[model samples]
Target: MPLSSTQPPTSTMELASPMQVLPSELLIEIFVFCTYNDAFFPLTLGSVCKLWRETVEFSPRIWQRISMADEGSIIRSRFLARTWASKSKPLPFDVDINAECADMILPLLAPLLPSISRWRHFTLTGEREEERTLLVSEEPATPCTDLVINFADYDSDDDETEGRATFTRQYPTSDRYTMTVWVHEIPASTILMPLDFTNLTIFECVFTGQHTHPLAVIDFLSVCPQLEAFYFWGWTHEDASLTTAPPTVHLPNLKTMTLKSTCMTRSLLTSIHAPSLTQLYLAHLNVDFQLPPYYSEDGDSEDEANDPSQSPSSDHATGMGLRTFLSRSRPALRVLEMDFSDMRTKDFRFVFSRLDVLEEFLIVASDMSDKVINLLKPYESCDSPVRVRLPNLKKLALYNCQRLSGDAIVEAVSARAEYTDANASSKLQTVSQVEVVDCEGFTSRHGQTLAKTLGNRLRLH
Candidate 1:
């Protein structure tokens, strides 16, 4: 009879490989490393053989991530659901589901609903209100710490879209009640959610409609006192209505803010008190630098203040609003970015002078005239006590600054590096990195000089 093919070779020349004889624990560890690149990856290795399948099936970490969507049929979804149920429970569950794939996911996920407290992150997007309601219904007791909601409302009658989003989380009475909402709109709509906001830290709202009541945004923020970051983006025509000055909402922990609007930014900035703010980004395309009357002592009417025919050079009003905001908040701001094509030289100086602790400053597609460069350059007064602007500045980036000259750029960098106090201590720290992108006047010669001062820290393109 022929020797059994499955049997290990008896001779010393041939023997069973060490891999085949590896312990179950070691094999499972090797499997985990093999599947680390993708989520729900062990499922691929589990199909090789009976022993390997059992090994993968028993590993909980290998099945911690459940990333599934419809595969064109209910039969496939049902099989996938069964597979998830049979595998180990992935703590801090992460899930992403949309309206189209909800039907297949809901039933499969029904069995895991009792353990909703394990969920840490989730994203839900839907096309209809009913779909959103159903999705929330299955997630009544989620302990999710981070969430994202995107909804699209499309009607057959018209080409435009109107959407409504609603998210409700039912926690199992825990102390950690903080949850963040990241909101955006592609098709226009309103977002509605019911949750405790005392512990919330971040709010990112993007408006796409002609108007979203400023009160609506304020109402949501008013309840979240612990909010740390906020972002708003909309177009010029989508003007927000603030009939009167809104109540000042204090966000003690807020550290970052990005606002993109025409006339609404004035009211929004004035109505918030963020003492911890360190980063501020502003983008406005409107010609008139009209701020809310609440900020102006003269109390000008909105129409007069918002006149578009006014020259963009009249940016003092806008600059004053920002300066007042900084003075009130008194935040140790480290980063300041702006997209101001016509920002006044004096206004820029006033703003820069206040940020004594600024570390990173970026000017994008803005005026970089000799006057602006002089304001940024560090200098000691000959008649009075010594002083420096942006003493802590380390990273200076100027993008598309057409008016900046190579000599001026070199002078600015060298001044910071050479600044010293009467006691010989460095008063103003030198910039370790300077990035000049598309600044036509800053030629290779300018870069060569900067490289000598900043060495490899100079990045020019």
Candidate 2:
């Protein structure tokens, strides 16, 4: 076989690629992403060719991450790791090795002991309790010098820790350390994760498991009394029953919170007392919205989703999750946004009954009716139950709310914006900004009617 006949002309081949034209920097980055999963990536990259071997040897960032998968030959793996790590030179490298593999990987790496203090990430698995840390300073941490630690995947139960990241930091001149733990995939641990939650101010976690439920995340909040912001994500739709569901987290200083994933909002709202919350965002949740970390694409959750009590009227629905949360928290919430949460007609009406201090309200892709719109129309009469609904609402956005009617919109906006009385005027201010996007019932007739009253305040998209 002649070489000329076997290969295509140079012009016909793809240009500026790995073989001959890419810059070394770009090539090294591409290599890092491509080979990060391979345990013995460095050795494999070096064996490819002279150029790659040189590139692998010279690029310290490429050498920074060393993952040693110990098969049968401990000696060979150790020697290869040693040679590969040497290329990192003075750069602090991240290392992952199994202590079960003879447990001698560390001993073999002893030659580099002088640089131990400089190691950025060091993971010794098997018998070793998985912990990766960074010592920040001699002094303690304060609110001014806040230290943020994203402790992802604290449990190696599923062997997903390859992507797990952990780092530590400290500050000087303070007496206490305010810690923040951001967990992904819901790592297993006690309610506190064995850390002091006294100073925890921000709590965020993402999950997809059955070992523990979102109930645990809700329970964890009880300790973080000083939290300012809380973010909970993912789907875990098993029957949520905690071993001891006694404590309800009281976040006195909490200002913002986002509850996403199916059934998550419902689960957490049952046990939270944030009297100072200002903003809240709920996405992909419904009455029985139990996703495994807790969202289901179909929005049809079994067992818990069909409960009538979950969507009862405000006064009668004290046991309702959202109602309970809103009642207990008494959030002077400035912003309330819900997306794909399947909020029922009664549910949102129930929600609005307590949010008299709410300013900005946005509900997207919900199946609400004209009846729900009545909540926006506040009457002067203290006798009216709807009078207390959204008195301070400033901005309203209803997008993809298919079930709402144009008549309802016009009536609601008119009542709130046009309601001017000499005696006992109730609303702090009418809805200044309104955005109604991709709604079926909002026809041009509806627009004309609204534009007459709300010259520029109304927006139809």
Candidate 3:
């Protein structure tokens, strides 16, 4: 019956099955790559779909790192609790409390005290007195592993002379893995507070005043057995009224140190020792304090000759403390940076020898004095077949050096190459590259001249 009526089959297209979906592991990886804002990532991802929300809820690692804006304390607490309830893995959390909103914000975080054990990275800035007091008392629900408290704003108020004292007395002691404190523009009384935490690895104290005592800081560091880095920035006054001297404290585990002072003397530099230090930074130092081996019978005569304006008791010296510190720790140091352009040329020569193992040397000299240039010049010529042994050097940076000419700088670097080759016994290795950055007085032509002089040895950035 259909022979005459047989028609071509309808042109219907076949439908393909849904594309194979990615494994949950792959999705989680994608989430991890996208994971950033502690507060926003979880909330935003939760809103995408039921499946994604479930995946995020179950991924504790994703929720472990939380950074809530001071404005979103309420949301942070609620989200945090829910994440915990979902059986997500426990991870480190970073909570940044806003300094301006600290008063209003402290109350919100108080309720989360029970869950504090979940915190691994706790950052508190501009914290209110009551809030800090409360946090110091709350038993960690989860042991905090890393804590960073910045009290730079303690001196932000005109009437807050007691801010440092309050912070020192009330600073929270955590059983965390590492702790760092940065205190600026505070008085000595604040600096005198004892740091009792034994587990701390990194500690920094920066004070700006005419009377900052380095001794107080040194004493505080001596108590910590696990300390790995210590930094001090002290500003002293010309008047001798401030009697507190920097303490001579030694931390055997310390690997990095930075010290800057407007009035530090040579003796202060020689007293401190940290045998394991790998990086050192010094700035705004005085070089005249490095006293000569001999002086006239009349001490007053020598004092007057050095500087009539400076009192006999005034401590001044170039690289005195640095030289002392390096003499003990230079063997381990890999990075060395000095901003001593404000210092005299005599200090550079005194300090250069200490940086024999330094792989990265950054110098911001006040001027390229002839002494400094000569000291920096390679002891040999470019034609010499011997290679310089800056054995570990990968990068060398010179900044804000106005007195050195491009040609002079190149010659000095070439000499370094020569010195390395000449001294077969020396491990001094030739630097793979030299970088000159942010030198206002240096022109592009100067850079070109350096490139030409050093040949392939120089890299200008």
Best by lDDT: 2
lDDT of 2 by residue, 1-461 (tens): 55688789878885655465788878888877766687467678889888899988788777776665445554566566666567776566776766543224333333333344445666666533355643323332222222233323435434654444332334354333333323332322231222223233323334434233555565556545556777655553545433333357667777877766534455567578888888888776544322233222122233232333233221121224566677667778888887866555555666787777788999887766777787677655666544547777878899987878888998887777776222234556666788888899989998899888878988986
Give all TM-scores, in the order shown.
0.56, 0.56, 0.50
Model 3, 350-389: lDDT tens digits are 5564556668888775554545656655444477653333
lDDT of 2: 0.58
Note the Cα lDDT for every prediction shown.
0.57, 0.58, 0.50
TM-score of 3: 0.50
lDDT of 1 at 454: 72
- The model with the greater TM-score, 1 or 3, is 1
Q: What is the lDDT of residue 309 in candidate 3?
A: 20
lDDT of 1 at 330: 81
> For model 2, what is the error of residue 456's alpha carbon versus the real structure, in angstroms, after optimal superposition?
1.7
